[model samples]
Target: MSAAATTSQPRRPRSGNRRDEAARLAVLHAADDLLVEHGFGALTVEAIARRAGVAKQTIYRWWPSKVEILLDTLIEDSAKRIPVPADEPTAESVRGYLRGFARFLTRDPAGKVLLALLAEAQHDPDTARSLHERCLAPRRARERAMLTGATDAGEIAPTLGPDATMDALLGPIVYRALTGASIPRGLVDTLVDALLRPRAN
Candidate 1:
């Protein structure tokens, strides 16, 4: 056989993966819509599949449960809106990040869904663990690093513990959300100020 005749043909392009990703995003969008419209109690794998116009098996093949689907949707939505700030001065980073975080908690859809998750966690240990591990833990780790940076820069008190500072900065925001109280417009600034100001000896 001639050498040219023996050459292999170019491989065909694959658009199947793009279709799959689109379907996956559709499922997530459906889940997010359901959470906002019907709350977590109304979200189910079957319902999401129906809403997304995909087979139930499709959702099951990717996510194990309704909560897992919801968690993924929540995380994806959050990443788009509340990205971690770039490295900068500690005071600026802390204040800006917290302000954005607090604003997210007070708005529609995201705030409502998060509050629903918190409520769900209270009764379901598995859900609680998943939320903490998948959602909360990563953000907490970042916050810890930010606090350590702030301390290293002398933007806050040297004596302040990073863990304690995290609690101080976040506790109020969570508390207000859980309690149905308004997150004051100035609460972010207030918290930042309180965080940066050293306690009098």
Candidate 2:
């Protein structure tokens, strides 16, 4: 998908007491656990509510559907696992980001959730819209900014457009994950070198 999709934040309940926050966390965790345990086809708002020990209405009050709950969980989990590093050289930063992303796809629980969502998106337009607007677009914006900074600093050649650059950098890792292929060691270094290495005069 192109990076032109508008960024939309995941929905959150209105500010509330600690009890509400607790219920919210409980629902998020419950959704995550259920998806991993039962897979997406079996996941339901009823199951999530039962697992969280909250009424179904509580979940509906905050999130319209199970997709929203999983989207929130994915966003929160990904933030913790793949934060962008600051104050590093552009190439190093790109390498680190790519490495962390590789691990996320290969090893993180949320990565499985992401894959499930991607699969769902193929047949469900709303899910596809939500996934792209809320998750993928924001991430693309961040990565594009980083690449733009590298270009401005003369650390990498700007031979590719922003969207193409993103596709080139991320497509291989994602394709490998989707196809169940193992990510070979040094692949991140290879991508960084190919995409971000400074051009010699």
> TM-score winner among the candidates?
2
Candidate 2 least-lDDT 10 residues? 1-10
Segments in model 2 whose C-alpha atoms lie over 4 Å from true places: 1-10, 86-89, 198-201
True lDDT of residue 75, candidate 1: 82
How well is each residue in 46-83 modelled by candidate 1, as lDDT tens digits? 88999999998767767778888778777877777776
Q: TM-score for all predictions?
A: 0.84, 0.88
Clashes of 2: 0
- List lDDT for all candidates, in order: 0.76, 0.83
* Model 1 TM-score, all chains together: 0.84
Steric clash pairs (candidate 1): none
RMSD of 1: 7.7
Error of 2 at 50 (Å): 1.3
Q: How high is the lDDT of residue 93 in model 2? A: 75
Candidate 2 per-residue lDDT over residues 99-120, each given as its tens digit = 8898898898788789889989
